[model samples]
Target: MTHGRQGGDGASDPESAGGGASDPEDPDAPTPSDAFGALGGETRLAVVRALDTESPRAFSDLAEATDADTTAGFAYHLRRLTERFVRQREDERYELTDAGRSVARAVAAGTYTASVDRDPVELDEPCPLCDGDGLVAAVADNVTEVGCGDCGGTVLRLSLPPGGYAARDSDEFADAVDAHHRRRIESFDDGVCPECTATVSARIEPAEDEADHGASHRDDEYVPVQTVYECETCGADLRCPVALTLLDHPAVVAFYHDHDRDVRDRPIWNVGSEWRERAVSRDPWCIVVSVRLDGEVLVCYVAGDGRVVDHRRESREEPSARADADDSATGTHTDDSTAVSTDDAETVRANDTAESGPAES
Candidate 1:
């Protein structure tokens, strides 16, 4: 788990080279080997779980909590965790640092210690593409998937830490998952990786129209293009219909609110006709997505970069459907869920994912 490094060249402090990561010679700078090495053994790990709070814990208490090879050996391990994961106060009491707290909670979240899945929970919503039945939500390998079994196509897929499902009650389970998952999507839309807070790059490309793929049953009914955001470091992948990037946009949210519907209450697949995108171009990328409510429409001009640059509203009976209008400057911007982006579309998939809490299930 790489962290925001806090080292500076303490040119005078024997341990520092005066510049942090910039100075490869800075011995005190945060490094993968050193950060992870601090928790390499059971003793060190136990120490992290023991001092899980900001309140200082005396050395004796930490040692007693994690009785190790020996008191001296335990003390040595504690020393190793000192700056990167632990902090020592003036009175010599110790506490977990910000990164340390994150580690503790993540462990509790079951990212490092658990694998989970659940039986399919039948959903009342129909498949957006095929209008098929048997649409259900299931978890496997820690990823939550919602799709139609009959067509064998996945409509939506996202990673969920073990706690994502295991911690919710049946009555509120689905809504909780929706809120959590949507937040992750919003994060990606903002050009930020929810997992590691890294800069996320974005682009637009043709969506997979494979008939055999999940939900591609409609010969011409498919998300024609998608916006993808990828973490530069941790490999978190988030892909969605270009319109989905506006899921939280003020205008979009207000549009749904005015219609007596809470858009956030349902998954993107369930939103059906309310949210949609059809590409306007591929080069430099542009997309026109319409949110239709009560025979009225709101057209958003999205650039390849995923930002909603312009918008207009019209009655469904209006003369021309803007779907055919070309908006050429759509900004350009992942396989977290399988929208099936292609080779020429600039797909970015990360083999390694960051810590698991709040990630796609």
Candidate 2:
């Protein structure tokens, strides 16, 4: 009998018999590793960089641009990059794919450059901690950071694309950074990674010491808390303040808009501190937020699953004079301080929904 590895039925495995080579007609599925591996060689990386000019280059022109000593070597590397990072057109010219262009831009942006000192870009917003004109933005080691010069606390810091800072003025660049940060926070709050669209888990917790400045500033005595979103699939992490996260809610935006205030026009640090008092319960499992905007008081209850379970609005008015007098005479103030349980809160939400309409998420 011939000795061989076999299945339970004593038949030889077809994979073993064929030496496990994938079928060439299988459409050549490419993975993320394959894309990264395409840039492993310096010659291959130079080829990608040469194609970053936003125009296709002929094979001979590209080989010349990359300074290839041998055409055969260049062709071998180019073949490896095909269908993933680089693509050849019908006219026999080659161009970078979207992934290839992104990688090329990153390389051009010096994302791997060593950390160096850079001047800070002045911002229009004032530092909430110090009440000074010291808020500025800067980029170093591929990270964009904004902070107060006097307080020495970084208000925001994030990694960006290598070309993130090119061809933009200070104000415009600041706006772009802010927008990027806002979108990321909103995406994370919606239980998805903005970068990879992977499922994310989030929780509200006190900010780390580096990210918080409560101890040094008297006005910022209240310890700041952050809503952290971590992706289970991609391992991407984002941390934003609880107030900032809630500010993106439709109801919150409507409330601000009704009061003739545009929340988006204000800086996050300014708005976050103002609304921090509204966060009554910042429990990671369940959060209860109450905001008094103008003459209306809005109460929002967020469940552990990161959904707004109940939201209700009430006018900020006192009880009738007679009721107040009666309560005063009985040594009990007629205050709307009743503790709301989950069931009662849900009931109030239902009643509010039936009376008016459900608040937008």
Candidate 3:
């Protein structure tokens, strides 16, 4: 998974995956433009396509697969792809390098050449915003959308890669989109960029205002606070509501566990009313995300930098039943929202979940 992002800076003798020490400013090394320029022709593409991608192939076998009129022509195209995209093995068989495999994967995924649109298909999940039962999933231009049919509010929006959507029906497409966002989000939560594995910086800010990362999701359809993550190295970024950051937090997971529900199984748009996030402070940026089930409430105090400063749970002596089969919650917080502090009151389970979920687009 290593790339050229390294080897250009730091260290007296940075090591190359090659047995020799890396040369930071090797004059003959291929430039980024040169690496891409080699793949511009049909002949070069034939060589890449012939690779199927990984098993090493003899030079004669590769030359036989391409439509090159002569072996010299095939050899010329192979030479252009060598070093950066294709590499020759010690056994004299040809294989793709990491960058070459990346191109093959992109080609197979249809990322650069595919477009898709699927009519709205009604989803069984309810809208978290309006609590409306008429929720639907739709795909257009390679992006999947889940919105409320009643309120016309968006529940989830994610740009899915073509391979994740093209062969799937609406239900499978929705599941694919949810799973994709969940992985990227989990990567972001771990303080790493999903694209390049760079250390990402994070902060919480007003949804309607742009943060330092040039992030602005300021439409009336969004929440009050939005969380932003940016990779200073790769300049990649991700945005979602502040509540999204707590989907895997220990207290929140335990609260859902106690109610006999798996929070991770719930769709990104059907997270229940307890997820209405708000920031009680902005100068120091402290966020309040509470998950309420029956008369039991779980409160998480989060800092602006996406850290959970503190958390506590308040429950009735005997809380009500778990959320119903229709995916709706029961029992609002009683007048005594702070009903417990003595022994049975602020009891939070110490369990933490490894899986995370998407709460926003």
Candidate 4:
């Protein structure tokens, strides 16, 4: 169970890098080994789970939150988790950074998905490998384990869709699939802006689509329309311009290419996490699009192996429960001891996630 590294440098206590403990640190200094090493253990991840779900807590509190005896063993894992982006200490108390939150959320989500599929796989269910969609056999006969470019799950064999053929030897194809899997987070199709209750659409065209005929020269002024997550109650639109910069992220573009290659000819249109994110990136949309007419919120996610996963309705009870529990145990209410600057916290968060927002589940 190796967690992938997509973000910036590994987690390190800024204070111990020959720099003062309180000094703000740069995010690019840590190495991949440093980052992965920090998060490679079960105990470290457990420590992370303890901090992320709970509010900021003192060392003793963290041990309690995890229901682990406050032994030397628990202390060691806590120290290691702090070194990783999974947990950060403030005034000697711990909490989850944004990046840590993302990773924990994904890991927890992946765990659930795995559990859901466990019985089928154990029972030798029909192609439970690809959730029964079937896979295109990989060209390499000896490659026993392959990650699904569509869902991110490991499969015993590559299953191709009907009428689609993969050129196994093509490096380009492999690269394309790798890229897709890397950026595989699920997206919202009906996000209603928190402000505007209306359904947000990512269908805005490039600004250059209707250029001025009289203009002598056209700059690259073709800005993609900004996507807005509408707030149904007040009609305020919230949007992130970066969300529209789809191809800007190499991983995302690669996702488009992979699915297009494997399922291009089929009448069935494949919709996965990558595809959903691409839509979110291109359209002015939300992750949980609101269907005001039905008073429903749409949610989506990516599976471990690259499949687009989805959940529905207004509440994420499971995630909310997990987050709430973590927060309750570790969350500290004090501003002085528990407070963390947004910049420092975000840096910690980004280090763990910079690599895979394109495919975040």
lDDT of 2 at 77: 87
TM-score of each: 0.75, 0.66, 0.75, 0.28
Candidate order by lDDT, highest to lowest? 3, 1, 2, 4
| lDDT comparison, 3 vs 4, better candidate | 3
Model 2 over residues 28-81: C-alpha lDDT tens digits?
Answer: 755445556667878888888889974699999888877668999889988988
For candidate 4, which ten residues in a row score worst on lDDT?
115-124
Q: After superposition, how far is residue 283 of candidate 1 from its true place, in Å?
A: 3.2
Clashes of 4: 60
Per-residue lDDT of model 4, residues 1-361, tens digit only: 0111122465533332222322136655455456556776666777677766677778777676554555797877667666646455457677877657766775765532232111111211223335554333243322212334445565432222111213333323333333332222113123443222344333333323335443332321122333323332223322332222232233333333543443222111122222222122222122211111122223332222122223233333443454455456656321111122333233333332345433332
**Which regions of candidate 2 are displaced past 4 Å?**
1-37, 54-57, 89-93, 114-117, 120-126, 129-139, 144-154, 169-172, 206-225, 277-284, 318-361
Full-model lDDT, candidate 2: 0.63
Q: Cα lDDT of all candidates, in order?
A: 0.64, 0.63, 0.66, 0.37
- The candidate 2 region of ten consecutive residues with least summed lDDT is 276-285
Q: For each candidate, C-alpha RMSD in Å? A: 11.7, 12.4, 10.2, 22.6
The residue pairs found clashing in candidate 2 are none
Better model by TM-score: candidate 2 vs candidate 4: 2
